[model samples]
Target chain A: MNQISDLITAFLEQCERTPKHIAFSQDDRQISYQQFEQRTKKVAGYLTGSNQCIAIAMDRGIDAAIAIYGILRSGNSYLPLDINNPANRLNFIIADAHPVYIIGIGPCPENINIDSQETQWLDLRDLLISDFSYRNVQIKTDAIAAILYTSGSTGTPKGVALSHKAITNFATWAGTTFNISQSDHIASLAPFHFDLSIFDLFTSLSCGAIVSFIPNRLTLSPSKLTQWLCDNKITTWYTVPSLLSFIALKGSLETRPLSDLKQILFAGEVFPTPQLIKLTTLLPNVNLYNLYGPTETNVCCYWPVITKQLQADKNIPIGIPACNAVLTIDKTTHELLVESDNNFSGYWQNGKLNTVTFKPQGYATGDKVSINAKHEYCYHGRLDRMLKCSGYRVEPAEIESIINQLEGIETSVVIGLKDITSGQRPAAAVVIKKGHTLTHIIKPLRQKLPAYMFPCKFTELSAIPLLSNGKVDYLSIEKKLTH
Target chain B: MKPKIREFIFQELIFVANPDQFSDDDDLLEAGLDSMGIMRLIMFIEDNFGVTLPDEEIDPDNVQTLNALEKWILRHKK
Candidate 1:
């Protein structure tokens, strides 16, 4: 329990120390540390390490929470595939990662072309807790604990695999930095797939703190979400900047007295200064921390927003390094290079580790950052065409490729439009093929892409404007869409 | 009013393959209208319909479907 490299051991130690303490609570259901330990052990018995990886398609509740730890306890990594995502994307990930065990509500995704003989599907209903021996599976050295898939430029999602050492290091740092205690009640808002979930799940539970699940249904209603937070007396909360902004805008913070909320941590995308100012104004006493990192390096830098000095004129810097992260800016590209203990082992592709992510110097973060007057890092956007839509990292190249593949599309350029709600929404400018109208492209595009990636605005351009060097003119397209 | 609601939702808030085929009782939340989309829907309602939806009233029961949304807006519009 003394900040060991093994996350499961730390969690187990905490469970022993505080067996009666509330571990996970959702809606009316609450699981104590002792109950969760018994449940996790029981669930682990079902997992035979025949396949080293498993895909959990369960809803974001008590079952999904138990399944993740159980899988890890069985010496296997897990991918918590968001069931809300388009089936096309989910099937792609299932087929790509090839999880031999699929623990979910029903049958594995019909589209996955896995060897039926090798695969096993365990229904949540069937896994009843009774008399079962605890499986003390020996975890291999440098074994991956979780695999998170992010939008890739190659028109497919890339899985960033993290080892137990890396996540434990992160959990220890987060627990120490935030002063998480047995008394603290933390809110789990971010979905399992996101990197933010690491702190929400591992950091809170491992530190003997109660982690409250924000109901999936309540996520869409900010006012109700605000009420839920106050009612729950959640001391710690972590999620994307957009959701925080949504709550501030419509949550009616004026009416709700969230006296227990001591800290708010936001990451995954930029927090607009205006909305940020509004949040600070609403919650004057609560501490605000802007956590910054790519999936490659989990939370390398962070900035604690100082309330009085928060000027609308100046943008909030990503701030100094955290979790023993060393940072440097490339002289030529000004790209932020991160070498951190929390850095992922590598991308998981075709059942092999893709270690090509690290450059000669360090992990070349696609993001370009510049140091502010206070020597804090200020974001300068992506070095590539990657865009953030509502904290979801989106690649224009990927969307363009999807669009190009559709029938009656000559070529398309996808651009991110500045949006107050989502930070940016993808917009497309396309030159349709002969005998094709813009209407023809809408249905198929929606079917293939998730709602976040769908183009909010589509333009039927005769010919896309070009630079002298033959690149598609992005500035021209953005202007046309806005006007 | 329902037509205006449909137009605004389909035009900016969400994507329905056939807006015409989508019934008034259809679940907008299931249709991928998230928190941000709901925020925009409120703004659209206030701007176009001149009805200010109180923050406390922004619950799933009121905004789950087109008919429910229209009823909530009309009740507030009065």
Candidate 2:
């Protein structure tokens, strides 16, 4: 099959063989493959051949799953909107996308008014209940599948348009690389809107693995999450490093028996070594992996945690490219370049292909990496986030990783602020553990880190500001530092 | 209830801020309670009271003062 949607039909045929097998689990609800297929067919029937851009404003549930596949079956690219986003941001995206229909699985926003463009509003439950037959339709591999919006460096959100081939390549490669099986139960930690969820959903579906979704309320609650993991017997989980750090610090993993968890994949940001160490200590059996990719490429490279020696090195290498993906580091700039089958078509609204100053041909990676003696790639933060201090160009991630090693410093952000005499001075915004002295911590941080890399200014924060996608909000920190 | 609220605020502020210097009426934002600090306070409030804070109620002013924060909590409690 050339297209990803055809693979879904294969999955459906497999479901017929194992109809009693559990397909999805959310909170207290569990849906079998048969029920899920029937519901998906109903949704597909209701939304056949709709050319209008359809926005799926549903929470993480069975209905949301149906809505996503339904839109794809109808030959329309689905836009997953985080209902928790600010009205202004949502309006900007909605206006920019100019969707013809908005599907709400739960409650639709009443405040923000849309333009008079014949927007069809449908409750997902009602749509799923409607009479419709599952018609096998042909979808081209190059056809646009989804448009995911991410915050740009300039504050505006840019939608990345992904094709069926890109998504299928990623899912197939990920399934093979991870050795995902029909018996595996993958936990969906990332929101449907985030690129992380694309692998969580599609990869699992392709392998006939059960996809379990954690409730939004218990997402950050470590204790609750621990219990959820144990209760569901979750085999695999995919999320950002920030959430993993939070869970590790809060002692969530220690509370429950996480022996069933086979794999833990972390992406979006750098996974701190200390947190990785703690995770290895708690659940040594679980295979820990660091997935590296921007939204442009779903996942280009991954470094599977092989041994403690790799973890102790402080620079956990984002391993070689997966199947159908090739990675090369620019010799001049040392920037990581990825030429992959999983690369997105282009940005949605502006119709610009790789305008972020990094894309060359099919390669669009913005990260600067250095190949080790072993030939494994070690990440050195974003090129734009790096700063030159005291004649030495310093990556903030280098100092930030060291800062996090300090006792009682829960979270740390290293930023470069403009100095009148020194050109640029590195400043750190830190969130210390309870009852820890900020001054005392910074003193030792100076000893551990170099003179130029030591934070010139130390600001004590209770928590690190998080973006909507759960990554650290560096823009907000920079704004605070400048002010 | 107000005394309890004050005590909770004092405890949380100490964990995150300079406890000895902060008074009940002290401006948290001005006294180094940044966005991250505000989020910690929100988490503490949610965990302690067993209440979920909606995204709409996470305004700067609602978390600025001890009295305002207390009022906000009480309003949500009802």
DockQ of candidate 2 is 0.05
List ranges where model 2 is wrong by over 4 Å: A1-7, A50-52, A132-134, A311-313, A350-361, A385-483, B1-78
DockQ (0 to 1) for model 1: 0.55
Deviating ranges (above 4 Å) for candidate 1:
A106-116, A125-132, B1-11, B15-27
Model 1 residue B35 CA deviation (Å) reads 1.4
Q: Which 10-residue window of candidate 2 chain A scores lowest in summed lDDT? A: A350-359
Q: Determine the backbone clash count of candidate 1.
A: 0
Q: Whole-model Cα lDDT per candidate?
A: 0.84, 0.70
What is candidate 2's CA lDDT for residue A97?
77
lDDT per residue for candidate 2 within A138-202, as digits (tens), equals: 77777777888875444356688887778888888888888888889999967788888887778
Q: Could you list the chain B TM-scores for each candidate?
A: 0.94, 0.71
Score chain B of candidate 2 by TM-score.
0.71
Each model's DockQ score: 0.55, 0.05
Write one digit per residue (lDDT tens) for candidate 1, span A1-483: 344876688889899899999999998999999998887888788777632778898777788888898888878898888776677777788777878788886665564445556557887556645456765876653789999998999988889999898898888999999999999999997888888999988998888999999987777778889889999999999888889888889999987769999999999888888889999989988999999998878999999998776787666899999998999999999999998888899888866566655775678898999998788988988888898987889889878988898889999999998877547888889989999877766677776787788887777899999999998889999998876
